[model samples]
Target chain A: MLLQQQLDGKITEQKDTGTPLLQVRNLKKYFPITSPFGRLKGHVKAVESVNFDLYEKGTLGLVGESGCGKSTTGRSILRLIEPTEGSVNYRGKDLLQLNQREFKGFRKEMQMVFQDPHSSLNPKKRIGELIEEPMEIHKIGTKADRMERAMDLLKRTGIREDQYFRFPHEFSGGQRQRIGIARALAVDPAIIVLDEPVSALDVSIQSQVLNLLEEIQDEFKLAYLFISHDLSVVRHIADEIGVMYLGHMVEKAPTDDLFANPLHPYTKALLSAIPIPDRKQRRERIIIKGDVPSPIDPPSGCVFHTRCPFAMEQCKSIKPEMLQQSDGHQVACHLYN
Target chain B: MEGYPLLEVKELRTRFSSEKGTITAVDGVTFKVDYGETLGVVGESGCGKSVTAESIMRLLNEKSTRYDGEINFKGVNLLSLPEKKMLDIRGNEISMIFQDAMTSLNPVFTIGDQIAESIIVHQNLGKKEAMEKAVEMLRLTGIPSPEKRVHEYPHEISGGMRQRVMIAMALSCQPSLLIADEPTTALDVTIQAQILEVINDLKEELNMGVIMITHDLGVVAEVCTRVAVMYLGQVIEESDVDALFASPRHPYTRGLLKSIPTITGDRSQKLHTIQGVVPALDNVPKGCRFAPRCPYATDKCMTEFPLLETLENGQKIRCWHHQEIMEREAASDVITAAT
Candidate 1:
């Protein structure tokens, strides 16, 4: 009875309580390509008019293939890179409007865990120092308090407190990811954008980190903008999933719904390609016809039209708008029309 | 000995004499690939899947590595072959495709020239004949407009196309066996399927054996005739594709199978994730390498490593309590669903 009571209390605490944490509207980030003369010649349309609502204490999985601008979208939300266009509202305040001083305070509420731990982490600094530096920069607590917190965070992330003094080289890939997670948690951010956090880790190690993330999210009441290329991992963690293709969210649905009956041809094709482990029940692989179109000079109209199996002539000339085809299910395809 | 395997590795052990110590990447791993069959080697990173493939091709740096095993290719022990003789066997009799096609292919050279080089090196063909053969190989791999694609550099083509080029080059010599190490890891699913289909088609055409080393089980089901599940430098489970998937003997293999999100199953449910992390090479557990993470691990399992035991119908397993574990797992699933 006592254990049941405790579980119920934890479950209620895990429920989202705060207002919508982030609201991105028609966001676009175009990185200018420079010429040999060091002048901005052209732009790479990385994130093109992507819109999504991230509720407080809720995870939103942003999934896409490489060069689909998923990472760019994550970075743009944090203003880690200035958006080329559109508005990002955090806690009802315009994030782009914040100046250097305001942005510093905003940084405390939001943090990012990168894909590659070694590259993101300071090679020279100890793991303890790495975790401490964030707290130090933000001036969260006293020196002794910060050190204690760092040790606790390390333990929370499944890393040994004794290894705090060791450099990044001393740890393995999974341990390094723990250190990365520890550093992200040091800030005590309300939201953490995990960009392919477990992609670099082994499958077994991936489960550990994922389970850790879920446990920590429950304990800390944290929200996540989980971005990854892996659909299976995303299905395990994400409540709501948005499928990105060539800088467009072609489909957005609840994880189960999307997987069960994907409406969009592109989404169906993408799902078909995932190698399920069952040998007896084989799925007819709906191979997308061509590679992802280059973002530099994206095709006019539907970006997925070139590869989509059911692409009509209308799809090639007119861009389809994201529409609510069902309850909480949105798709951007002419087939629905 | 009467029915000879196309390629057989007997007690294969590849060790690297690093400054720290002699680290054995592939230790005492034995397997076989018969003609017109696909052997899927599945394991996580550093589990020596790629290393096993590399050792087969003798691609590992010879200066720092030591090989002790009989790699019998068509009855000849490749480990004892001279460099020149091994070279004759390498591209002529057996070919290998790497993970990254861009890195494997030279950027400056056209696709035709690169593939022609392999044909010229391995076979007694003139430049024109080699170029023509390269086009035929490209066509065989399902590269549309091979004549035009042949003139393009590695950078000019797409990633999938680049992989097709690599396959074309590999099959140009019409090797009896082909080693593909994560050939589609860098490719998208649609492209991966396309490349896989091309390989499958050519295998049937040439009667060539293929060794596909991948972490993805789905790929194995799609192409492989047999599979060997590796864990911590050992083949923990090996069986036919059907039996391996139906009733996986190893806990790790079962965990892997369950962890995968299948479309046919209840997509609403959470993934049956394996509980722990893959231990690092240096910190590999003593008894069963998977015992630490395994749910059904007993004291015997923790203290003694089980040898690969042949089960019903030639299926091999390296687990102490596989039967008991499967029963418990099945019961647990039912109990959980009821609740």
Candidate 2:
């Protein structure tokens, strides 16, 4: 369906083809390190020149280690943390240029679900009121309408109505996470940035939450930027996967292609590092030596050259640009060149 | 005594009296660990995996915690040992490495000093000789430049390095038995792989009987010789790592295995789930603890508890309908293979 908009007092019909729900380009977030006296020492480049396009009703998974800046990329897109440099284009609009009052309108279109559900949900408020509070903040509906919507959302997310009046402390970890999902859906967001949504849950509960997320994605046609450190969980839910290392997007590809033929050496090592549960299928693992380097002073060219198995002389002096290998496969490595 | 296992825990029942009431955290847990063998105790949260490890060490508060079981180390009953003698056996003979390496290590002391202190206390070594042994242990764990790294404090090193240091300290005195409780849980995937490799190499070198307590089945499959699956406060199934993965008898074990999203698993298929949450300790069910979540639970399962029975294959299963479940599963496997 073409959306008709009144732009400059004239009606214009815009086609939805080739328009991504969200586009992040050259995203860079650098936290300045300072001494106790407030003198700027240096900058810890958390995220550098990361780019991706998230289409509507699609899930893009971002996988990385602890300091690889996957969570920073997700938060920067939602403006939860201001980017040092980059543009977040939401449906052809630059969300970064918008002021607080103007950005409030787009906030309703995008919501975030934090990693720890225990700290994310308020302990004092009843579960029902917590879900309705988001709608109340956005001024979307009346008190009774919000209550009705909240109750409906709770039931849809597999929570019983009898527990609506209970506090967050009374619920289990899985149930609290379900309540978090219910609250995120309260604002009717089109794109939800889920940062390690099920990482804290047990295996059985993690699967239940994953199934619930898939069902809601189909029913509401929502897009997700699923950020997690678990590759298996990401492979099951995400359509496309992006691997990041030391604040750079080393590779991005369709889930099937990435798993079948990973291009980057880091990606290969990460895939092999996962301990397969089956005893008969122990693949030869490429164990990367040494820990990740400090982001404050990342390697001169490629941040991964410090521990990369196939690092060349050129890899130490010149950074490899992300090159498209196939239709939807991209890799940043000198081997491809 | 010469032919006895390195460590054997018999009917290990651990209870704690809290403000609410008394709760049996680890009930009737029995297992044996032999030299050069790693026994993995896998379970979900609140399943008494950690408590079992702590009870073996007698680390819990003696005032509130009560124990009624035989924890035999080298054919000696540890439960009857006095606190003074238990202190001598705590780290010298049986050492433990906790999940969080940061809190387990002393922050104020250098890693070398901490390692040396253990050696001096246990092996009757001088300060300089103990320091040399500490650096040697760090080098054995594959830490680069151990001479320099030994001077660094716990906070100065990275998480993976800290974990390696913890391993170095735990293995410094050449303990016969090692109890690692989720040692790599706080680490990243690649780092976890490295740590597991280090542990594997050290276990072979020392010929130590290792008890690995974790919730990750993948870790168990990688490093464990035998696996024991725990539910609530009991071991639901115990078998060799290969056998447990190939054909898990208990319904809870099957459900847990199916729930894990493996990289090689078909993405289109929905994951299998256990129906409900684990019952609280105070509100535990009267019969089988897993009956509420088990799909094959019958009326008999709700009122009667099943004993842990050993099969012909030497695998232990605690389920009344394991034979029926195995037969049905075999039939389904045949049908699927035919298709």
Candidate 3:
């Protein structure tokens, strides 16, 4: 009651396009390990002090290898998992401070689409009911209105309305992903965190899904937090790309700038390792020397120094801050300094 | 194309008996793998590329699988070989590696014991000799500090090192033929590159005839000398790696190549995708299997099946309208270049 009273009438106010739709600062999510009996063992710092902003209709792509906490970062932003420390500012309001009942009101504008569409949807529910369940929970419309809106969303997502009555198991992987996208858009969300949306689909179906996402983002001006491991897919959709390594945002730059001028040793190694489709366009591959260090007791100072080819003695002892490069690009490596 | 191949598979058909019926996973698959050459079998899942590999290895259970073909490995017919003889040839003359090393390697045993077990079985070496050779094999796969890693279990090592351990076990006996099925699929890209480089280097050192099975065309372009594109149960197209990418003869192959987003190409355009998904294995098509999703499919394609015919440039295609495909692709090439 006090939180709502503090907000008063400003809760529903819309901000101008000049401001970022979402601003996250010093975000961290550390899972504490417990001993078999009861005592705290250690901490798995899955995500540590990440910061970024998403403008209206903008997508910030997060790229990293498996177990790098890209998925954890996305989940933390939506408060699916409680953050250890950070401030998620939405139009000047701090989301981290919101209580359970207060955050419920913000759920309409913030949603997430998971990686595996097969497991994300309820197997028993019809596609129409699945898409309409969100609007019904939020009480945005009546039964009839929700059904009509569900049909419209089905059409928008390129699924036929007649097929909406079918169960989840009846549809193919790509079609199921489309239904997943429609469900995310059911409550008219301003921002959606898509976690490896196309990784499960085939190459051809992956393109179809990516094109649909681009089209929908343009139509609704939706801000997206697209997380994927494939650099090729991330470059096509994201305006700005952030490279994560052992829970750290090692590099951040515009998509074109990141690919063309990768400064971080880990980022450069990742780019060079991607296998080119064309046989003739050959380039030297910089295969990192060793496997990724364990996140439990990650290498001190810099997590990537174990595999980095250009690691200096300072990288082992002193941690580097995310320092600014030219024109919004940022790199967290001692070589840049 | 050259002298006698180290291994040749002809008219290879593999069928599994299910509750529905007997479904032929690989039908009339024919290919030749030369010494020191890598032949990439590229396809989507359920496309029988892995079945082709397993069929050659005779790894599938004979009670459930019925195979019809001649898998001649250096003048020996693998199909008609005795069980004892086949056992002798499995790891000694030919070897196999799987995709997920975590599941493939035994968790209870140390990496050294698992690798040494193969050497003991194949080379008839005793415990001490095989253990020493296991370390040497692990070192050959580029595992650093092989002496220490030899005592570690599969779970203690990283995924990349586990994959390298699997490779070490597979190559310990120095088999002349190695069949690697998506060996690097479970690793990260940099680790995948390292594994591929190691595989290529070993292929040269051992002069092995490798049948590399994977779904990645990029991996195919990087390491494969020749490529075979598989559809539901057959090789749809086969050519040199350069030629297959330059002028893909089959519609499915061409569509597969175009669907992947290329780093060198323009990002403004949407990818060209095949219209439909792969048909179910139970519902084997009556005619050209890919006809339903192929744009240039004709009435004749729906009724008559095409055989694999060798093209003028040593490329092989299994399509009735090769002439039309050539013409249409050439015209589209000019259109794309003009734009």
Candidate 4:
């Protein structure tokens, strides 16, 4: 199917049912360099033509290595960073085209939980007051009303209400993360961009946060663009997974489908490298030859061609279009093309 | 086992005097590494894996640090050696590669000069001879155009190249033992594999004993000949690589093995994560340190910590209920695997 037809089909599908909470198309964010004279220099392609959709009650796992534009994509969608190009359609309204007043209204519905819990939360403020500040910014209710909601959110996120007056340093790593989650939930956002929310956590505590995320998703009917480098957590939480390389989405498929039959060579290499605990079932490790090339001057055609084990000459000259090989399985590889 | 072990650590305890109190970072840990063998140390953060490596090299701050145990490297008690004597043994007999390659490498010096320093220090080689040896070491580490790359600073090279340089400097003396503490944790997966392969090749070429410390079990499976599973600063389990993976004797080890997401199998199955977090140093459990979290903990397990007992095939286990737990787990595998 052509790209236009696939997009139209998705729109009709969403219209036939209910609208998707968030839809992103060709979103690009580039960091501009300034010359010594403070003139705008060439831009760095932090995120490039990324496309994905998060339904009303589903999680879309945006996964890649560090500097693969996962965080930039999240920040761009939330409009925390201005995109150099593309459309962000949230609830049928193009968020990219929204004015400041309109964008402020949309901000209440979209929130972000950052990677580092230790640095994300304010050290000076009490836990309750920190959570209440969001409500204060939005001017949602009276001071007493905001505190009551803050206490409810704190209790909901598995923190003691009595400890609400305590500082963030008083809590453990896991608890501090929970407080971060509570602060994000204070605004009652419909969509949450969880940026490496559990990467800072221990493996044992990671599961707890994951379980909590699942529970919150179920209860509030939340949509998440879960960005992370860890594939295991994405498999556990996301319904759909987008595998990014350099600054492009190389593959997007259901978690199970992507895991079972990864189409892209880069995806295959990544999967093969993950160490299975069981020693009996040894995998033929596909050792990719070289390191990831510089993103500023990414390879002309397929960004992954440099490290791709099965790269052809054509892969070096022409960019492969994102083509659907199966239902919900799209890959941008010359082999697939 | 087969040939003589190159390095052996017996009942090693590394303590530090913190502002809070005297804390034992590594408590009564013991393991051995045969020549040309990679013994992986697997544990969570603050589980004493790094401290064990630091203790072997005597790298901790001496004023606030206290060590109680024997680190017998090539028949010499590294603990009893004087500071001046240890300087000879450090890079010449036993070397270490730290986690962050960028921070570990001196920014002011070129890669060649850094590696050459070790050669000059350990061997009586002149600067020119040391430079040639440095290029040889860099080339051995699989770096392309080692001679050209040697003159570049640490910042000039990629993370992978910097790590290779670190490996080159560490093995410049051809140390019988190499201690790597999360060497590839900062690099991407592809680079991580390369670093692991580099370490493996060097271990084989130099006939060196390698102690690899990492939290990722997958890396351990790929490289380690034997594994010592540490928890709360103690070696909870120690066995051959295959045996440890096949039948983990300790609950912590079992949980760690299960917790790692296997790329080979079905993705639908829920990962068996260990329930609770690692207890803080001051809040050490009165009984088994893992008793608060272990699913198989009983009244006996809650009252006293189990001694490290030698099981069949010389596998060491620090759990009182290992026999019973193994039996129950075997029976439940049918149900667990189906799910």
The top-ranked prediction according to lDDT is: 2
Please, what is the whole-model Cα lDDT of each candidate in the order they appear?
Answer: 0.86, 0.91, 0.89, 0.86
Residue A217 CA displacement from its true place in model 3, Å: 1.3
At residue A223, candidate 2 shows an lDDT of 86
The lowest-lDDT stretch of 10 consecutive residues in candidate 4 chain A is A6-15
Candidate 1 Cα errors over 4 Å, as ranges = A1-19, A38-40, B1-3, B260-286, B323-339
True contacts kept of 2: 0.82
A211-276 in candidate 3: lDDT tens per residue? 899778867879899999988988887778999999999999878788889999999999999998
Q: Which stretches of candidate 3 lie over 4 Å from their true place?
A: A1-17, B1-4, B335-339
Taking the tens digit of each residue's C-alpha lDDT, what string does model 2 give over A212-285?
99778867878899999999999998888999999999999888889999999999999999988999898898
Residue A274, candidate 3: Cα error in Å is 0.4
Give the share of true interchain contacts found in each model.
0.47, 0.82, 0.63, 0.49
**Of the candidates numbered 2 and 3, which has the greater TM-score value?**
2
Q: What TM-score should be assigned to candidate 3?
A: 0.95
lDDT of 3 by residue, B178-203 (tens): 99999988788888999999999999
* Local lDDT at B44 for model 2: 91
* Candidate 2 B-chain TM-score: 0.98
* Model 2 DockQ, alpha carbons vs. true complex: 0.51
| Total backbone collisions for each predicted model | 0, 0, 0, 0
Can you give the DockQ of every candidate in the order shown? 0.44, 0.51, 0.42, 0.43
lDDT at A325, model 3: 93
